[model samples]
Target chain A: MYENKRLGLLYCLPFVIGVALFKLFPFAMSFALSFTQFDLIEPPKYIGLENYREMMTTDKLFPKSLGVTLMFVALTVPLRLAAALMVAQVLNFKLKGINFFRSAFYLPSILGGSIAVSILWRFVFAKNGLVNQAMTALGAEPIMWLGDENYSMWTIVTLNVWQFGSSMVIFLAALQNVPTSLYEAAAMDGAGKTTVFFRITVPLITPVIFFNLIMQTVHAFQEFNGPYMVTEGGPLHSTYLLSLYIYDQSFKLFNLGYGTALSWVLFALVATLSAVAFYSSKYWVYYAGEKERS
Target chain B: MMSSLIRSMVAMGVIALALGSTVVSGQELRFSWWGGGERHEAFLKAIKLFEAKNPGVKIKAEYTGFQGYQERLTTQIAGKSEPDIMQVNWAWVSAFSKSGDGFYDLRKSASVMKLNEFTDNDLALGTINGKLNAVPVGFAARMFFWNKGALDKAGVAIPKTWDEMFAAGKALRAKAGTKAYLIDGEGYDMILMSHAYVYQKYGTPYVDPKTGKIAMSAAALKEWASIYKRFQDEHVATPLPLRASLGGVEKPTEQQPDWVAGNWTGNYTWDSVIRLRGSTLPGKGSELDVGDFLTLPGAKNSGVFGRPVHMYAVSKRSKHPEIGAKFIDFMMTDPEAIRVLDLSRGIPSTAIAFKQLLKEDRLRPLEVKAYARIATLNRNNAITPPAAQFEHPRMQKFMREVFEQVGYGKINADEAAKMLNEQGSTILQRL
Candidate 1:
């Protein structure tokens, strides 16, 4: 028993060491860096609370970026969940050549945030790009999709929503697991297909829907690559998400301390949001094995 | 287990042998730069020549486009993993060399690198606090480059001055509708053009370097903003919305499809970028021509923007600083090297090198013509703009923001000026 335990510990060693060195160490360093004034070129000087104060009170971009990030999350999360659920419903049917459609839909999620996709997206949304060309051909005025501040954020949201394959797969799995007997029973009870779906299918998949909701919400809140690559947090900083702001501050501007401070604020935000999500999930999330509470 | 262990041991031995051979064979240096197709091609040729002469001393060239080069270099420097030889920006001198010791002191290798090849004035630009950290490759200036065919096709003559440019804008818009603007009035372009306007009126640096304060008082800034506001209002340049629809202003005009298509007819850019701009036009059938930088009708001073060309500096962390210095010497002075480099960077920094390029016909006809104009401006009595220290991202962004606010009518000229003084003070104070 002791030898078996030792083997198990040995097997886990690499993962523990990897997390300690790459993840946890950097996490702690960034936290410590939040209090300092560092330009990365010069040695970091401790200037307690100055970076935080500057960001909150003086920097206008901070609040603007935060608002932009929250909007992206609110829009993309619900839309992505809806898209994934609708597609997964159809995908769950035992239809012919279904695997090809599944792979085709999954391609974007697998290749999402890559440079190739981002470049392709720019061409699609550019003023003289294919979409605008088609619009002009149809005798309609061409819209500046990525150029206008009003519509630029939607481009990134559309890009994010299109890559809903992971959530769809999870929904598909949960749909398959729902016993056919329950649907038949509801059908025999003089219920129509829509009635059976509402009474039988949905409640049965509440656990999976709740899971996807939380996952997509977190993912949408931290969305960076889609906006960074597509819109460049630009056209008057319209698409400037919080993650992009942090990256620009830390990497582009070399204000690592301020970047760290911004990241910590983001961490608190995401943590609070996730906590709220979990608390709310308890009311709606049904479990397979747990007894129902009166 | 024995077979696998033996295989692992052999692998380790092979790794060690490979590492040992690299160290024993010769010095390996990494040289990094950012440029367009022309520069990358020329630099690759220069590297090939350098490698052939240096024998076992290998130099690896790391190249990228100009975007994010500074940011990447900053991170690499912070990590102490920068290239040995760097194509350093002039503004980076003030940024990285606080004590004048951020880069390797090239003075130590003067004999090998041939420091006497450069004129004193050229040498002075790279010298900081008595430390020769970098050497200027050439001197460059910002000017107006017009596509002659585009304007001629529209029956618009080449604009020789601000009045002509304004008239051209009116005529072109009447004739071509929204087909073209006199130039791209991106935020930075507007700021530079505003400097020329303001400097001609007030013979002083935009910002007082000594006090680290803006030279233009709130009243002066207000006047400047009003003039700038007038320029944009008259539609002499592409407005923000149109420029945005076109593409990023930071990208070379050549890279923009609008520019290639002759929808944007002129550019306000540096001399170094003119060829790249020209190269992008011929394929699209537009004839690139050097036009006169627009001046006020009776302008007091040219207010010509001039600066040292991009320089080569060695990282203090480089294990092979000597080899890096030798490479710089070859790149800057060698006859064969100059033939390969041509005039991709700019006119050569040294007189001898220029004569060589001219004699060998290495400098293209257009380059020679461009150089004559630049030489005339260089010799003119003009107000030197603020030092590169003022080229900080914070200051540049602040300048652009103030101009943008005024241009967009988000705020009035007086408000923009007052806000600039207040916020500019804060920005300077932090630095």
Candidate 2:
């Protein structure tokens, strides 16, 4: 048994080493660096809460970026989850060549965070791009999807919602696990499809919904690539999310300490929101065997 | 069981040994740069030639497009794992080498490098704290280039002065319609444009390098911001909203649809990138023509912003600084390397390379014209070498934001100018 344990330890060594070196080390270092002023080329000088003080008082963009990030989260999370659930409902149906549709829907998520896809998204929403061309063909005046402050947020939100395949796949799996007997019983009671979905389907899939909400919320808070590549937080900074601000401070300005401090604030916000979601899940989320166990 | 344990231990040892041996052997040096395709190809050919001539020395080339290059270099520098040689920006000398110890001093390698080939003025541009930190690749100044076809269609001549340019803008709009503007520019261009205008009229730089403070007074700054506001209001340049709507603020003007189609016609840009900027115009590059330097009436200075295009620097952390220095010398002074490099990286700054290229008649006609104009400007001392702090990324962004606020009517010129002086001074002090 000891020999067998040693073999198992050997097998896990590479992964253990990788996680400690790459992930854990950086995680600790970033936390330590938050209290200091460290330009990339120079040694860090301990400043002790000065970075936080500046963020609240001196940094003009911090509050605005936080507000914008909150709005982005509020917009993207629901829209993306709804899109995922809607697509999952249709894809859950056992139709011929259903796998192809599943793959096609998943394609965007695979390519979503890449710079090339972001560039393509920018061109797609551009003034003389395909969407505007189509609008002109249909006798509608072209909307400045990426240009106007009122509409720029929607472009990034739409891009996020369009890449809803991962959440959709998870929802699909949850849907398949829902007992068919519950649906049949609802149908016998003369429940309409809408009633059945609300009564039988939604309750059984609440756990998955709860899971997806936490994930998408966290992801939306930390969104960088979409705003970075697309609008670049412009048109009066309507799309200037906190993640983009953090990146600009850290990488572009080389204010590593202040950026790390901002990152911690973002992490704290995400953790609190996630904890609230987990606590609220007991009321709304129903597991299959949760009642039985109780 | 014992044999199996021994075998596993041996295997782990072998793997560790393999990983440890990954470092390159012998006299190999890493060199990194960022450029467009033509520059990359020319550099690669030159490197190949250098290697053939100097047997057993290997240069590992690392190159990328312009985007994200600075961030990558910064990270490498922080880790103390930078390449032996690097292509650095002129503004980066102070930022990277504040005390003059950040890079390998070229003066130390004067025996290996042909330091005498370059002029003192050119060398001084890269010197920090009396240390020759980098070698200037070439000199570039912002100049006007107009689309002759578009100007002709609008029945307007290239404007030689500020008033004429504004009049021409009005005339072009009247003839060509609202979609047609006199110039297409991003926020940075607007900052430079206003700087040139303000400096020519008021004879003050935006920042006083000697004192390290905001040199433009509140009234001067007000005029600076007001002129940009006027540029937008008068259709002399594209409105901030229109430019933002068209593409990213950082996107090259030449790539904009309106610019390509001849609706957005003129640009005040670096002379170095004239070929790249003009190659995609409507008339297969024939439509482009250099315009006279715009000046205001009663101007005290020309306000032509000129500086080194870029520089080649040897890393102080490099193990083979002498070899890197030698390579830089070859690129700057070798006849064979010069013929291969051509004018891809602008006109060479070194006396030997510049005179040779001109004598060989290898320079393209358009560049020759640009060089001649810049030469004339330099001879008269109309061109001022910009303070390095003026090109700091943060400072540039602050100016752009101030210009943008005025352009968007979010703030008046007085308020914007106050921000420029007050807030801009704070930023400069921190730097």
lDDT of 2 at A262: 95
Please give, for residues A1-294, the per-residue lDDT of candidate 1 as tens digits.
876677677668879999999999999999999999898889999999998898889899898999998989989999998898889889988899999988888788988768678767877888878888999999999888876878888888988999999998998899999999997887788899888777788888999988888788778878888887777776677888999888878876668999999999999898998899789877877888979878
Clash pairs for candidate 1:
none
What lDDT does each candidate get? 0.80, 0.87
Candidate topping DockQ: 2
Cα RMSD of predicted structure 2: 1.9
Residues B1-431, model 1: lDDT tens digits: 44565588789999999999977467889999998788899999999999999898888999998768988998899999999999978878768887888899898778688888887766777787888889988887778878888888889999877778889888888877766676764558667777777766665556775666777766667778887777667767766655555444354567777677787788877777677777777543238777877777666678778777788999998888888899999998899989899877888787778999899877666667777887766666353535664787667767766776676677898898887778887877776
Best by lDDT: 2
Q: Each predicted complex: what DockQ? A: 0.46, 0.64
Residue B172 deviation, candidate 2, in Å?
Answer: 0.1
- Candidate 2: residue B334 lDDT (0-100): 95
- Please state the CAPRI-style docking class of candidate 2: medium
> What TM value does chain A in model 1 reach?
0.95
